[model samples]
Structure formats: C-alpha cells, structure tokens
Target chain A: MEEQEKPTKVVDARGSFCPGPLMELIKAYKSAKTNDVISLYSTDTGTKKDAAAWINKSGNQLIGVFDREGYYEIVMKKTK
Target chain B: MVTNILILGDGAAGTIMANKLRFLTHREDAEITVIGNSKYHYFKPDGIHIPLGIKNYRDSVKNPKFLFNYGINYVRDSVTRIDVDNRNVSTQSGKNYTYDYLVIATGDRLVPEEIENFDREAHHFYTLEGSLELKEKLSGFNGGKIVIGPSSIPYQCPPAPYEFAFQLDRYLRRRGIRDKTELHYIFPLNRVFTMENVSNYVQKLFDEKDIIYHTLFNLESIDAQKKTVSSLEGEDQKYDFLILVPPHKGQQVITESGLAGDQGYIAVDRHHLNYGDYDNVFVVGDATDLPISKAGATAHFQSEYLSGRIASEISGFVAEELYDGSVACTTVTGDEKAFTLYFSYTRPPRALFQSKADYLLKWTSADTYFSGMLRGVM
Candidate 1:
C-alpha cells in the first residue's frame, strides 16, 4: 500500500451508511480533475458491495478495498 | 438574501436544529422558525418507565417556548398543508408562513388502528395517553399471561419494547406474583432485534429472566374477547394482558404535501438529506425514509450535522460535514440495571453489558435532554 502515491482526497465516512459513503466519494470524484485519486472510509456492512458496484458502473478505476480496524476503506481513481 | 428557515414539527430533531442553526447563523442573516403540533417537548425514552409507574406523563413533558433559544420563532400551530412548490405552509390557524429553506422533522405516529381490534385491549408505552392507561391496567392486574412486543417494524426507540419486557419481569417479581405471571415477547424480525450481537445479548437476558419470546412473529389480528393474538405466520397466542408497540407512520402532512415516498416518510438523499429534487429542502429524524432507528439520539446526531450544513451553506461556505447516522439507545434490564447501545449507519451495534451506571445514565438522560442535548450544546 505504501508503494503508490497517496489519494488526492480522503473522505472519512466511517460511521456513514450505504449511499452516504458513496455520495461523499462521488462528491470528491466530481470535484477532482481527471486521474485524481479518491479514497473513502466506511464502516457500513452494505457499503462495500454498493461502492464497488458504483465504481464499476460509473467508469471509475477501482484501486482496492481494504478492511481496517472497526471500518473499511475503498480507494478509487477518477477516469471519466 | 436572508435565509428564512422553516422547521416543521418541533420534536427532538426540529428543536435541536432550530437552536443549533440559530446559534451558528446570525439572526440578521437567518430567520429560524419552528412549527409544532404540540408546544410540549416530550422525553420519549422516559416513556418506558411510565407503564411501570416509575415516571408519570408530567415528568417527561416540557414547554417548547422554554427550550427554544432566543431569537428563534416558535409557532404552536398544526400544519394543514405544506405548499413546497410555493415554499410556504398553511396552518390550521388560518395563517401562512413562507420559507427560503425547509427542514422536515415532523416525526412518525403510532397507528394501532391499522390492525383489527388491536388498540381496544392493547396497552403500549409509545404514547403518553396509552402509557397512562397501561399504568392503570397494571395496577389492577393480579396475575396472568402478559404478552409484550412491537406490532411492526421501524418503530421508534428500537430497544424500548425489549426494555419494557425486562422491566415488566421485575415489576411482577416486586408484586410477589412472578411465579403466577407469565411474560412473553414476540418480534416481527427473524431475531429479537435488528442487530445480531444486540439481539443475541438480549436473547440471553430473556432466557435468564425466564421470559418466553418468539421470533418471526408478525402480528395480524387481535381478538380481545377471546384473548387470542393471530400472526401472519398462521400462529396464535393467547394472552390475558397485551402490550404491543403499535405500527408507526410518518406525518400525514408530509404525505398530503406530496413529499412522502413510503409510509408517509420523506425521501431524501442519504448523505445530504436533500428532499427529492430540492436541495433547499431537507429532512431530519424519523420523518426521513432512511434505514435507521427513529430514536432521539438519531435525531440529535442528525440535527447536529444538519444545522452545520444549513448554517455553513447560508454563510456562503461549502458545507462539507455529512451525517454519520450515529444512534444511541439504552435498554433497561430490571433490578436497576441497563445498557446503552451506540452505533451508526455504517457500524453494527456491539454487545452491551448490563450495568447500574447505564441505568443511571438512562434515567438521567431525561434531565440532560432538556438542559444540554436539546439545547444542542452537549
């Protein structure tokens, strides 16, 4: 994980819900220039599936999904 | 332009939001107005103690005018119509109020009439009137089979019905009729609660307390004369006394205003709380169609975040902070013991160890509610 450049924007949505984390990620994505990296922190059990689906459907590059202590992290890059 | 903020329903959510927004935004920049169905602010968590006779209806009630911050306009009027398209509301008092932004905190209502012959025999703790009635009935109760549980899902204060059962077990024991009385609890969910760990923890307590409970039991009809309760699963349970948490629905004014999506709840963006297709309109607390418990703490957290958003946006700053959906609920286990469950939209509730401190905290919450929490300073 330390081998790559850090995310341009990190959205801390640890206690947020399904569409909440996804919406925050999209907000970051919308403002970021093309190729800007965005990472989202969430603890919602349903967010992993929804975020992954959104990253794929929205034509964004899904870098990785990592499980953290009491929460999870999803990293993506704006392509379109 | 001055932001004319109109908050509908001055419950836990609306009151906190009104006060917080007023504190954050200048009075000259934002005119914060709250319209309420009742002038009294109710401490609903203390409602569990009412049926058990620990607290009375007067103990949980407070005047809204006393709680509202200075410079906040409070209208003690019933809303007849919400003309959202025109950005104004018409009340039953023959007055119209206009707003530049709308915040809907008009909470849900218990609908016992939705079930067949349910309310006539059932005694619930959700309402002040019902709790008072239940208290009277409990005083005359000798000993019999008592059924306690919610009639439907998404009811406010998810842990309350469970708390009542635990408290009821103790109440019967205190009356020296524990051996003669039978306590049974039925939940519509596959488990006792929505969360797995909390449900498992509560299930163990029920076992230790010798309280019988049934899962996946969706109530269908009640025959008060025959003392039989029918379920959608084709099961029947006979009871001498019934205590059912009536099904809940959002405010009727929301549905009549054409702003509701399902069960009279307003549909809004999950993160921003923006009403469907209107960024200027937002929803907080039990009124929103969010998959969260409609508890006081849920409204408190939402109000905290929502006030910031509205205030920041009005102050011409980018509103960045979003609601995390944090909710805190306390379940009282009899014998002066209770446990508080703290979780959010993204997080699942963890196991709660019953403690006397939590019981004290739970009881003291009513006091803190009026002094700090509702003030939006705590």
Candidate 2:
C-alpha cells in the first residue's frame, strides 16, 4: 500500500447522511487557506460521489479516497 | 369580512395544511376551504400492500369528512380553472370562489399512456384500481418471469420499487413458488438508487436474494404482442408479468392552469414553498418540482412550516422562518424488518440499518398517518 498523506484538517462526519458530509466538506473548503489539505471521513454512501462532484465543480485537487474499516475518507487539496 | 384560505386537492398536504391553518387562525378571522372530488382521503403508501393481500382496500382509505377539522369547509367538486391573477377559481359545478391565499396540493396524475402497450401489459400498485387489478392477477400467479420497475423518473416513492421486490421475494417464498419464480428489477439511473450507500446496501440484498437488476435501463416502450419491453439503451427483456411504476404528471387542474413546470410539476421557491411571483400561492407534496422524493412525509413537513408562515403573515407578524426540506419513511426489507430513511433538502439520507423496530413503525404508520399526522396534532 502507498504511504498515506496527512491532511491539514480532518472532518469526521460518519454519522450523518448524504448531504451532511458533503455540506461539511463545503463549509471546510470555504474557510481553508490556499493549498490547505483537507480530509473528510463519512459513512454516507453518496459522499464519495457527491464530494468528488463538488470538488471537480469547485476546481480543487482530489488526493485520494480511502475505504477504512467502517467508514471512508476523502482527501482533497485547495487549488484556488 | 372573512379571509378565504382556499386549498386545492385534499391529499396529504392539502388536508393537513387546511387543518394546521385552522388551528393557528380563528374561524372568525379566516375560513379554510378545501376543494377536491374524492370523498375519501387515501393513505396512498398503504396501497402497496393491496397486491400482497396484506391490506384491504378500505384500510388504505378514510372519509375526508371525518379527517377534516371542525369549521373547515369542504367542497366536493373538482377545480376546473384557477385564475390566479384575479384571485378567483372556478369549479366544475359552475361555482366560483375568491381567495386571499391559495394552496395547491393536488399531488400527481399517473399517465401510463406515456409508454406504448403500458395500458395492455403492465400492472402496478400505485393506484387503488391498479393495486386491486394486480392483486387479483398476482394472487393467481404461479411461476414466471416477473419484471418490476418504474417507467419514468420521479415516480411516487424513491425506495418503493426496492421494497416491493424484497416483499415479493418473501411473498413468493411463503406461497411455495420461490424456486420457480424469477424476479427482475430495472432502474433508469446508473444504480438501483440515487444515493450510493443505500443503493449498495440494497444491491447487496438483491444479490443475496438472487433478484436480478439492470441499471440505466430507461423504459422505451412495451411490445405486448411479443411479451417484451424495450429500453432506451436498445435492450429488450421478455416478461410474463410486467409491473412498472406509472409515469406521472402534475394534477389535471395544475396542468390546465399552466401552473405545472417541466414534466408536469409546479416550480416553487424551495425553501418557502411559494409559487413563482405569487406569495399568497403555495404548493406542497408530489406536485412541486423540488428535486426531492415525493412522499407524504415531505408534504406533511412542508405543511408545518407553510401553515405557520401563512398564519403569521395573516396576523401581521410576518415571520421569516424557512423550511429545510425534511422527509422520512421506513422501507421494509422483508416481512417484518425495515430501515428508516430520514433526510432534508441539503442533508443526505443514512438508511442502511434494518431493524424490527423500524418495521413495526412502518406497519403502524397507516394508523398514525390519519389520526396524528393528518389530524395536525403531531
């Protein structure tokens, strides 16, 4: 397995549903500085797609999506 | 002079709105009047059980007269025209009424004719008549290729097709035809559901139960003569029993009045449920094009916020409370196990956990729907 990249901020939103994790990601993205690496942990099945959609739409860099034991983690970097 | 609050259609939204409005406003100040043709206020969700012989037709229905709160007016006539500019509506009975506020909760109109051969080959449980028809046929069915799916986007309930499939699996097993029957499900989307997690969870269940599913199989038309239904993707599936969720449009009056938006749905302010450019006009339920699942819970939630705002405005308070789209329901996976789905406009759903508690809740929801939710007390 490749070495994991540490993020500037980690947001855990495992208990929330589809939009909840996505909503939290947006909130974190808006306040972060340029080049700030952010990671989001979510249990929602749609967050992987929804967060990626938001990232692509907002012109950010997607690092990777890691499937953990019970939840998944999405890491992205602020590009603009 | 009494302020007239006219609510069109007596579906879950309209009836509850009228009742909630009645509670907040004094009868001397404003009179609530509902217009619809149906004498019975149907709990439509329970209609799905009809084909399985789990629910009686009468069990899914209630007299509108008994459901309405005292002092509210009931007009047992269909609305033929809505002249919103003049604030007047004309009914089929040649009667007209002027309103200070209008609520359009007419729900959806199933247009099965959208697909060729649908009228001849398909059986569904979305409507009372369709459910009864399917029940008679389904109960007599022994073994064959049973295909079930929605014919179009934005059908009645989001999780209904999946639930129907699981319930049918159990039903067939109980009837000793499990080994002989083949169950197939088709969805228009890329997955079995819109949400990724829920879709994955349901896909797992489908796999375990040996229920075959096809994603992105958009319905084209059915060739009843060939006993086959074609998809937009050039795929064809032969079937002995075809059950497709009826394609829908906005209610008749809504379409006639030019109030319905794309695909026969009303476009409204997502937060306030207000009709375009008309503050006094509101919409709720399956009628609105809010990009949310059309369920009774959605309409009921909208009613709570809508009635409060209308009442506040009428009382000169002018509250600024906005509604966050929230809808909740229980989807049964089998005979007595279900999972709860709850979400809002911005929040996604977390509904993968199945429990008997949720199943019991789903079972008793029909009773509470009429007594508590529709009664506007819960």
Fnat by candidate, in order:
0.00, 0.00
Q: What interface RMSD does every candidate have? A: 13.1, 9.9
TM agreement with the true structure for every prediction: 0.82, 0.82
Could you give candidate 1's per-residue lDDT for residues A27-46 as a string of tens digits? 56657898888888998876
Clash list (residue pairs), candidate 1: A44-B346
Model 1 stretches with alpha carbons more than 4 Å out: A1-80
Clash pairs, candidate 2, are: A18-B348, A19-B348, A45-B197
**Superposition error at A72 for model 2 (Å):** 26
Worst 10 residues of 1 chain B by lDDT: B187-196
Report clashes for each candidate as comma-separated counts: 1, 3
lDDT by residue (B1-378, candidate 1, tens digit) is 788999998889989999889889998899999999674677888778887888767868998788899999998899989887888899999999998899988989888899888868888888777788899999999999999898876689888898999889998999999899999999865568767788889899999999999875668789878999977545689999999999888988888888874479886787788887887889999998787888888888888888888888888898577777788877798889998888876677777788999999988888898998899887
Candidate 2 local lDDT, B147-167, one digit each (tens): 998887677887888888988
TM-score of chain A of each: 0.91, 0.94
Give Cα distance to truth, residue B280, candidate 2, Å. Answer: 0.6
Using lDDT as the measure, the top candidate is: 2
Off by over 4 Å in 2: A1-80
* Leading candidate by DockQ: 2
